[model samples]
Target chain A: MKHWKKILFWGLAISLGLVISLAPMPVKATSSNQKLFKIQASRFAFSPAVLAVNPGDQVTIELVSQDVVHGLSIDGYDLHLVADPGQTASMTFTAGQAGSYTLRCSETCGAMHPFMVGKLQVGGNDLLWRAAGLALLAVIAGVWWKRV
Target chain B: MFAPGESRLNLARLRVLDKLIKSRWPLLLARSITLAGFVFTILVGLLGSPVGSHNFAIIFVWIAWWTALKLFFIPLGGRSWCSVCPLPMPGEWLQNGSLLTKAQKSIGLGMRWPRRLRGNWLASGLFLLIGIFSALTLTDARLTAWILLGLLGTAMLLSLIFERRAFCSYVCPIGGFTGIYAKTAPLEVRVIDSDICKSHAEKTCYTHCPWGVYPLAMRDSSQCGLCMECLRVCTYDNISLNLRPFGSDLGQTNSITRLDETLLALVMLSSALSFSAVFIGPWGWLKSAAYDVGSTAWWAYTGAYLALSLLVLPGLYTLAVWWSQKTGQAKAPFKRLLADYSQALLPLGLFTWIAFTIDFAFPKFSYVLQVLSDPFGWGWNLVGTSGVSLPSALLGAAPVLQVGAVVVGLFWSANLSQRLVAKQVQPARARRAILPLAGFSLLFSLTMLLLLLG
Candidate 1:
């Protein structure tokens, strides 16, 4: 409970947390490039479920419905597309936001309609890595609190 | 620094609070309201739209009630929901032969729950049964209604056969869920003084408790339903509702741990992991398999699910406990030690569910509003805001929040594990003894993180 020690531990914690969150990831980006994804939407899934792209890249998606009616909406971005069976709809947008966005089925497909989702990885998914860092810090802090 | 659940701020000292708890009117009123809601949910589930999101029974029951149970009720108000739970209300009314008072002409066989069937095995088994088919139950509105009907029927049947709240004590999975996690909530109902009880002739609290928990014998908040019957019935003014720190009943070395309760905790943990995989992960084939019950793929899914819950997780936890015992060289019997230490898993398991709620429930919350306006999805928009389908408000913060919640749980469990080992092992070996348990917690946390956000 000493103020100095507590401050020191927290200082280290905050610094480590910031570093983990903001530090350029090893796989972040070599160069910005155009990215295109032809995503197939079925009853409850998107083929190539995860789409990886660099931040600031021009990203275009060609959404194709394999069966039934399906739609794709990217979370954190105002982009949506719907297609009928054996039809194609496309949308083009710049991948301006970094981190991960979930791709959800906008249309009510079937039983597992709510759960049909994919991931849009813009950069290195720094949030997850930062969270992992913070988790480690939480354990250290917990153990340290008990010890001191 | 102090005894578990010992640090007290007696909430009963507040006059308004005292009155609220003492009166039967408030509890009766609350239970009546929930009973109405429960009946309405069953009706809507049976007669409303088949779609999960658009149905009141599906959205309100699963999304709203289930989420609230995990995030708020169990964590903040231990067994408080049980105090006003409508599932037992119908039977309780029949038992009392009145709405808000004990009738002279009571109804029931007044038989005791079999000692052989005592403990949480039935509750955990019921939870496993429900979880095995969660994909269907969670999605199909009719199935949800049928399940609710079945639960109500059983509660009523047990009330007539067994004495007091036997369905709640030994049957309801939801009750079991709350009872175990209620240990971490910072509230408890206990006697102000034990000598007062000993000096008194009539033990009103024990005689009146619906859950059959004797107030003086109660060591934790696990069994107490917070009914306040004891609080009201006691003339000596001996019962006190105290506010204490979290983890108050957790990891106390002196308390005896029931194998059933420990197994319940493990089952809950396994179920959380399973839920994350089946519900949150983007595995369409797996989801379809789980939903398509009785198919070869579904049988495969059930096998894997059973193996994980009944065998893998428990086996792994046992191995970890055995390692801790070997390294610490503690003399306690293996099952006793396992049960005792399993209390550490409470926060871990609870937080996993909380994070799961964040992922599974938070995004679909708009559906709560949607269903409110259109309960049956029969095109009658009562609120005029029916067409509004806003995306997740927590879209950006959900992952960060989920991660924070999970790690905090791991931190709590890790800290508790260390303390539990320190009580048994020498200070020099305490860290080593706790390593296995710590590793187990970390592994569980990481797996959840993977399923939730990876």
Candidate 2:
């Protein structure tokens, strides 16, 4: 209700709008991090199960489905990419943080499609500090509740 | 100020806005606009246009209705949306051209059917079940599609049975939410010239009420849907819709009297709590149980889910009261007070649910993207070519935001209990309500934190 609060609210709203609308693109020099990764969406394997990338590094993923069409959804991130059979699908996004994440198959590919999962780990991001803060808060609350 | 069934009321002497609303044109205008909007939404859904379902306009309609009902209804106008609801489209159609009218009239099921068992919690309960199922199964798109289909079926089936737009008024969780919140809206239809109503022998409004509610007993805002049907049927031009302050009826006695409404309030609160706990928990086990096929440990998982949903949360409040009584505390009935307290959280829970839908559900699976891709003639791309790695910091903040929501919800419940008990108990007794409420909120939050940590 305060003037400053209104301004801050609008500022945050605008930034959120921009983030949701704009697709993540290569920000740094493209050639420096131009490594292509092949992800074959076959029966039970995703070829290279583990992918390693660096912060601010641009990488292309070429995906082809050997059997049925499979969707790749990443938890904790806004990525809704899908691949179809025979046709190759590709998209470029920067691996902007350091953490292990599951690239779960969203589309019902087959009987074991639910188990068709892959991993991605990025290096160089201050994720540790935030995780620590969460842990610290939990610890403090636990102690306080016990004392009560 | 008029008592039940009092024909000579002093409502008209109160204002000039009454004189303007006595006109029939206003009633027609309001009904037409509402009907247009309702028809448009249904048509758009039937067209199966992703843009209509996915675009901002549809979301805005639901959000605006919710916001208006919550902010305006409790303090202002009651049962006002009922005046403008376009639910009896099928009934209206049947009256116009259907050959079944003769058979319907001849059969004469009549009004003698007992009104006591008229309201059912199962309608709202089914709605809640569907909502939970949708949340667990798929995100927004599938859920929205399912809701649209369900509405079509409800409209079709309800038109045939129980007579006169009964399903929407007596059933429908969404309608119940609107009816409850409409208590806070700022405008209402009242008898402007009671002298005319008194002089006229025929009570047309009573007979014409689409939902079969007696117009004379509609002094309370809770049962009134603000349909202005009474206004249209009044041959003497006695009925008038007038603008007034919000929550004007809150302090007034004889507000809402139905036990079914109390049941509805309980259902709303429980559904909200169940949704928050199940979807936003900190236990990896819950997620595993939900998403992982083999994680189902049969009875243990099923029992825990049932106990948590139906018993544990509600039981905690009951237990608190038992504790209070054991400590030699004299007070009001705990069950009734808990019911009222939980109902107060309905608005706050609705707000959080909307936020969750927007924050987590909307951005994830968008039908709009799928439709837009169709123009390029690329049918379905079902493979993940791009790696997914959102920052942990952002992902980690979600559980905390959810915790904040739960805390706010609990405090609101506590405040409602205090208000309800103000007349029956001392301030100390009223304050006792906060302890149990806050404890439950904290417990739920910590359980969620553990779920997230896993």
Candidate 3:
């Protein structure tokens, strides 16, 4: 190969690597796992799927995915973590807004993938929350294989 | 001594027929595996739901099968997939459902008038579109699954409406790419006895070509689907699957005209660029934004990316050829000569594909594979790893094998180009042909850049 071609090849390779590695890391937003929450990252169920946390409260989500890999992504927040089998990835993010938030699985699981979801009803009456939890649990248990 | 209208079986055709009759086990195995894989891919895409991560597996299957056919079988079998492709099953059965004995071969749809549009161009264009689509929606499992089902459906519809294998010949992009790339394949179906074919009457081989490619046109061996319909139907039985030199029959007679050759070269380069932008470009942020914001801008970005990827590279390549010829003091007629030799770039494109597999397909060096698959999660997963870390032995072996394959592929292409040039150039002044060879080298360099960057 000619000298110019070799130079061009190496230049492109080096620059690409530098760009990927040198890109600034994302800023860490306020998180309350000081407000601890067990994120059951299993197939078909998010154990304790409904969580009601006050605004500015930092929440820690401990992730577990039973089958394949699952991702815990709460849109509009910085809780994007992939939960692998037998491995739990924890992400800490605060509930900065006081609106109803959706917790959706970022990674693809089989069949009803789009429907694998949970809801975080922020600053609601505690009584209505309990009833929704009971119903969500029944659906989860029907799909979940784990006895607990 | 020739009987006027009587058909006779000759030794060459007899050999091919006897092989086809006896090779049922291999044929059956090939059909069963390909059909099962095709069915399984579609089912998984539809029922299980496709996601971004699983698209890699789909790509793996698609690229692996394509590579296997183009690199190894094209030279060997000659459109052998047609004999065994599962796509034709639904159409054939629909035309002659279940009652095998009563069903006639003709569905009585009379021949449609030959339109000015050629089938090969359509087939190639369609394949190019699919390839671009696959790369863009790489992560969308559902989309991948839908594309698979859609392609199969299109093939069935076309086959049902048109006579013979028009779907395979004209519409399916994969088949089109295969037909072109197969030119470089070393194995070909050939007449074992020339004397036998010349003497035989009632030309069954010419008439029964399932893809409707005339046997006389077998000089352009790249286009032969190797469906073996001619072999099966020939009374003379004169064809044999012979191991010939790569591109041997491609240069024998011209099928792809100069203009067509230039268009194909453009298609190949643009497709490669389009693929690379996703895998290697700075569009990662935009891609993430699409998923996050669900903005309409994502769609526009994707469209622009594809247009640039599939169209720009080839356009630039043709422009370069024109510029090079003009500056090289070559006139319009000489420029046309350069364009004719551009068909030689087909091998260069195939070489790019080989290099791509070497760079991207090899699992050990692929960082993305480590992030996605959890191999130990499944008892005996065909794809995936126990850990992200590579085993030295495996990693060492893969790149070595891949580079070796790339080197071998380059040499194969170079040899093919030489033969093609020899055929295109006038016999007396053949030695003076230099400009196109330089163009080929430049294209090859660009391919290497794309591979490395990929």
True contacts kept of each: 0.41, 0.03, 0.01
TM-score of chain B of each: 0.97, 0.62, 0.75
Give the runs in model 1 whose Cα sits over 4 Å from its true position. Answer: A1-15, A18-27, B1-6, B391-393
TM-score for all models, in order of appearance: 0.96, 0.56, 0.62
lDDT (10s digit) by residue, model 2, range A67-121: 7897776556667668888877887887765555556666756433434556565
Interface RMSD for model 3 amounts to 25.8
What are the candidates' C-alpha RMSDs? 2.2, 10.8, 17.1
Model 3 chain B: lowest-lDDT 10 consecutive positions: B1-10
Model 3 vs. true fold: TM: 0.62
Which 10 successive residues of model 2 chain A have the least lDDT summed?
Answer: A139-148
Q: Model 2, B1-454: lDDT tens per residue?
A: 3435543334444555455345545655676787676555444433432432232223333334444554344334456555555555544445323321223342212333246545545555655555444333332333344565566467546655455666666666667766655544455556665666666777888766656665554554555666556765677766655555543333222333444554555455555444433444322344334433334442345455456545665577556545544332545455544444444434344434433433333222233334333311134333431223234345435434543444344334344434443444555564453445435434543443333222
Q: lDDT per residue, candidate 1, A7-90, as tens digits?
A: 887787678767876787676445768888998988688988899998888888999999989999877887779999999999
Best by lDDT: 1
Off by over 4 Å in 3: A1-148, B1-29, B52-60, B63-78, B95-105, B108-110, B193-201, B252-258, B280-283, B286-311, B320-339, B364-393, B396-433, B450-454
- For candidate 2, give the docking quality class from DockQ: incorrect
lDDT of each: 0.87, 0.49, 0.52
Give the CAPRI class of candidate 1: medium
DockQ of each: 0.60, 0.06, 0.02
